[model samples]
Target: MNGNRSVPSRAERLRASATLHVFYGGIDLMVGSRFVPHLRSLERSQWYSREALLDLQNRKLRALIRHAVDRVPYYERAFHGIGLSAEDIHSVPDLANVPILTRESVQNHFHDLTSDDWRRRHPVVNATSGSTGVPLKYLFDRDCVAMGWACLFRSWEWDGYRMGDRRALIRGTDFASKGTPLHERIRRHVERNLVLSSHAMGPTQALQYARAISEFRPTYVRGHPSALAAVGKAMLSNALALGGVRAVYTTGEQLTARQRMLIEQAFRCPVRDQYGLNDGGALILQCPASDAGLYHIIPERAIVEILRPDGTPASPGEAGEIVSTDLHNYAMPFIRYRTGDLAVMEDQQCSCGREFPTIRRIEGRIISAVKRRDGTRVTGLVLSDAFEQLVLTRQDCVHQYCIVQNADLSIRVLVVAGRGYDDTVTNDIKQTIWSHVGKGIDVGVERVPEIPASRNGKRRYVVSHAA
Candidate 1:
């Protein structure tokens, strides 16, 4: 060391050392887990021709079918009951013979659905948030998690996300700076993220979060659409800015046009919405070059089918139920699983030149089922559409609402009042609900200041205490 050079302070040296440690540690984790290879493979696969993509999907489908029928008890019985063999499912269309796997089926046959060879693949157990109604526990292998993240990260790259870019995550986790788990802290530190709890978001907390975003200068923000929109609304009201955020990514809930507009206006960036099921059977992400409201399916990860109520395929532009087959979850293969969400699938290729299929719109989930005295059940989506239509035509009166079914088959409508709301709007909503739900069911409407979101930051339009 030169005698004339000033020595660095101990604190400065320690800070520099810590920063280097985090940087190297992050690199080690990324490389050691084989995520980089998967990312590269997915990036290349996204550019494959539609025919090529379908070919790859068919190959994976065949392998999954063989594995499922041989090792999974549920699929073994299902295939045999239909007098079909694994070889019978030669293509995507042939999967129709296999019975539709409902959420209830997975819940009831959790043990049977899980592969007997789960231990060999390092299976990890996880549960759904139960936001829709009932939570279901399932298993996934480490490779499934890693490859899914790789596919997701590749899509994020389209919106200018790079490794080590500062990110602000506003989701449904505890954001208290104290008592954070070691793994969570390490993730935040190494990935350069700031996690704000969605549960505690209010006007004051939004302002605080906006300030943090400005200071952090995150490259992007990711979270539930409603939570992000709330922050956006608060920021706009408070005249705050999310400094230099290039994009906003929304997931876990439906991204309405109003919410998208609010989020984009507040953040001064584009909003990219994503749709996925907890079962790892489906993933659809918005393409950067495409406009909002259009999501391209990640064909390499899952085979998605938009089927009619009768289980046949829905025509393009016609809304139908979404059934998906996970291509990678060998530990617990969810073949022909019915995701209760509805969507209108687009047959045409995206203008951006990608070969993946696009979904024109996602009509949220079916939500809770409303049961009647005779044991007949009605899906909550019917009541939800009624409220949606009322709000669409009469936004000035009905801001938001939720339908709750009680034990006695009575319906309680919790409403968030808007400007000029009165008895007329209330009566119309009640009548609409009654019309779809049939006669002899008591319907009541009550106004409230606000309707709180579910723990996972989802605003469930329907809740059933009866179920």
Candidate 2:
């Protein structure tokens, strides 16, 4: 979002939700071609082409309008009240007449978001991981899962990765055990993967992670960016080699330029980023190094759109909301549902002639707002990027810390203390942070073995205590 983009009024936000709920409640979203080769072929067809992307978008859109007009209780009433008919909306070109979806709409009408048949058999339950506030229990079918994996594979391929190539996932999985026992080691050798525990990333634990990666000699390193950043920092101090990792795939949290620089410098590989919220969307992957990535809207599986704050269509240059339609996941075919994120659309033909529509930048969910020392409020918790810039000048000092804003404007800092933990250095960091966020910054420190991570292994730089 632009610095000047005002927050939507309560009523406008509500109305946007109403429109989303009514429209989504009515549509029968469907998808096929779950394999990579099939998907690659489909890219040449009507739905994946630029004309087809727009055409299918409009066609399905008209179908949605018809569904809402005929079946949706709320949408039928709204369409009737507007003096419009399903017949009036001829194509996706006419989608403008219909309202845009919003986060509020999804939350308020959660049950109405899907069809009844979708709730039955083969309903794959998935969640948004709560990175954004409105964490939803979504549904997907087998095809949805396959398409998601296929999209992920495409990201890996962009990074010079091939199928069956050794890929080390530095993430927490149900697979991790207290120790790699005989059976687990056998599995690792067979699968050619070393699963690192996300929760165990302290100094000693990092050594274990490093040893695992070094021994595996994986072709690509993948995990939450924040977790990888911590591992990168650890590798820097310990002089642990990343071995043969030609690429690094990071997802979940926003990848800072500084973090990217550090990870790339440490791993000696292109640190690529993939975007997805598990909100009825597929993984939006890109090789940032190639500059050929536009987060190609997965045509056969998902329909993507950018909506302005007024529930209006956001043109090329504007930063607006991102919404997706999960086509393959009929169990939770989130039709034109709003995802509360700010992203910019780019219509420019990419340097790579893939002809896929792209999103230039997705300014993620802006929810870190908090009261500053001056009584003013800030909405994002990314103030840590301010601290993330701090280099590791000495190996003996605490390198990173997160500020937790409380309801009373006070802040608490969670830190990784160095060997010689003392008040002097701690005071210096506290004072420096206050210098940036402002003076009179009542900050307290809590020294832990290491920073805590979410179940996904992503580190939150700043979190509201209230959250």
Candidate 3:
């Protein structure tokens, strides 16, 4: 151990543990939730046999279906119109009989989707980031929120994280911003969470965040991959590193290969990618037991189905849309809801011995693709790979970028210049993009101070306005 390094005293550690217990205990008591119990159940449930997991899903599904049909007006009417009932959906496969719930449908039937017994569930209203131009408001029960935290904590355990472990959060939610309530500030301090805003991740902000995180010495760092990658780049540029970070957890955005590499190099820790949707009720975490980028689906949290366009289940290795049923959300059930995200189905069991189903890859949102003039389409993953490679090879040339496709199929590359940015770097970016998307399209590279984030403070790498 370095003599200069500061270690927490025994009394400080005991105080931190007691504070965490009181904080979580107060929350559980206020909401009538059993968070710690739920977390413990999940820890054991993750190792259940495949048949046991499926049986658990079936039981949860039956109960949820009965509740939705009896209490939710939207599901009740839809089931009646389709000549179906809760009895028709006894198993996961029987869910095919239910209509696919779309975002537009939810918006139209907002009030109808709420369960009649929602008042008893301690409901909380929430909204999506409206990244698609229209935000959708929804309801979440207190128990459902508690289950979400339990599922997340269980996933974090794959990286050796414990409940009271010190961690840093670098995402859109700015807990340190002005006007934050005193209680919220105290809660953050008691929880030992270092929250850094990702809204404006310029070089200066990135440097500051890097310095703060390094000094904080968190066991793990969690944030959007883009934001973390920016801080990682800053740390590398200034030769700074967070000495004791065991892992980096990335969510909210796709974690590209180059981004993962940069983060791992800067933090000297492995990067774990997590896929989740608060509105959609899907939580997929990277399989720590495998290096193949496979994600394990939490069976107790949501029942995920990878279905083809025809509404049939996709075969293993086939790419399909993700439809999820959040089992714990009774305030407003999302049964067979279309999440609009794509993923590849995997049929193999993980070496970790967890019976939870797996996904080979998360292909991102369905609408995040670029169309070419010749009717060809390039997915966001491909474009991100191209841009990431360009940045990796020409290090310090580009801090951030957004590839926007105009209605006319013209491509505009908006770049936040880095220290080593030059004309050659711009040409390299253009060439990289042209390689993936044919040169027949008009491509322009523009240097900017920063790329704008969405309403939720997520910086999208690809935005297509072409219809």
Candidate 4:
């Protein structure tokens, strides 16, 4: 007999594959079964080539349009009014034939926008409480919810997170209630995630949150950029170091370069920014292979288009309004929805093998400027930069702050005071604002319990009423 080892038989290989399926199946059961199909689909879709992905997109687009026209009254009317039919929109470019759906349209025809049959599938209805304007209510079916979570978790996996890996979230949710709710405890157990309340955060609270997160030994930390930066600043000031943190994820607010630097330096991890809307559409996430600020659009979730003021497609690196269409969510079809946000679309492919396209940067939503006494208009980002710079320099004095412009051209600065906060700090902030916005504008600083987030879980740095 030859002294050689024999290769494993087909039976043995089949047994090994069976064991893996069982192992992952058990984990899926623990995490909840709805995500199983969606997660697997996303895993497979990422490997698709550009042409294959677009082909898949076209198929989904056709199905979505057919469903919209057949079931949703609003789309039925929109298509008929434009002398277009579901058969006419066979590709992404054909989508332009259907006019853009504005927020006002959604508000005016809320019922018609939703499919009556989808309610049986457990559709959740909610409203977006944006910082600037009226809230817009929308519907997301059960499958849509699962798909969205799957895409979100896929992004988390880019930073080395697994199904049961521990993570911490600092969002607008009120987690500081007297006691945790039963459902919340169960949710945390199932998801293996913790929530730190952003609404109750201050200097003292930030220290507590930092300590709590340190104890949890979370694999990832996620929250609004400002809130996360504040906690990171607190950690740095107190010489606190959290171990085993794989990455920090920021969303729901515009993340500045300074915020990324602070968060990364304090946490000893990279910061990944995610952009999307609450209407169950437009999910763009930063992939592991992307540069510092680049994000990849989840092709399965939505089709994102950047259009110029002339209603034409913007060139690569040209800033334009972001118009997106949800490829899923047939319950409430949002075709050609105007997101009101601005971004630059990258024409180049990423080093990552994934075919998902990249967004160069997300400049915040379009809003009128705060008119000054000299007929000058100052945008929110410009004035907000003054405080952002302060946080960069004196990390201990200011944690989270906001600037609000009144109708009389007076400005009010709301400060969630941190360590070293005092009259001198207030005066410095006033002087900082005066320097940029010009004098004769009444500027006042007010310390508060917290700078509450808008209803949709966003902490806007500036709210202007003058414009």
lDDT of each: 0.78, 0.62, 0.84, 0.78
- My TM-score estimates for the predictions, one after another, are 0.82, 0.73, 0.91, 0.83
- The model with the greatest TM-score is 3
> Which residue pairs collide, candidate 2?
17-105, 58-92, 368-379, 368-380, 368-381, 369-378, 369-379, 369-380, 370-378
- For 118-206, candidate 3 gives per-residue lDDT tens digits of 99998889987555778889998888888898898888777766556788998787544645687767767776788788876667898
**Quick one: RMSD of model 4?**
6.4
Write model 1 residue lDDT over 165-226, tens digit each, in one string. Answer: 68899877665644578777887887789988887666577778777777788878999877
lDDT value for candidate 3? 0.84
Each candidate: RMSD = 7.7, 11.8, 3.7, 6.4
Question: lDDT score of model 2?
Answer: 0.62
Residue pairs with colliding backbones in model 3 are none
Sorted by TM-score, highest first, which candidate order results? 3, 4, 1, 2
Report the number of backbone clashes for model 1.
0
**Backbone steric clashes in candidate 2, count:** 9
List residue ranges in candidate 2 displaced over 4 A: 1-33, 42-49, 59-110, 119-121, 128-135, 176-192, 288-300, 307-309, 313-319, 344-349, 369-382, 391-397, 408-411, 419-450, 465-467
In model 4, where do residues sit more than 4 Å from their true spots?
1-34, 176-184, 368-383, 394-399, 405-452, 455-457
Q: Provide the global lDDT of candidate 1 against the true structure.
A: 0.78
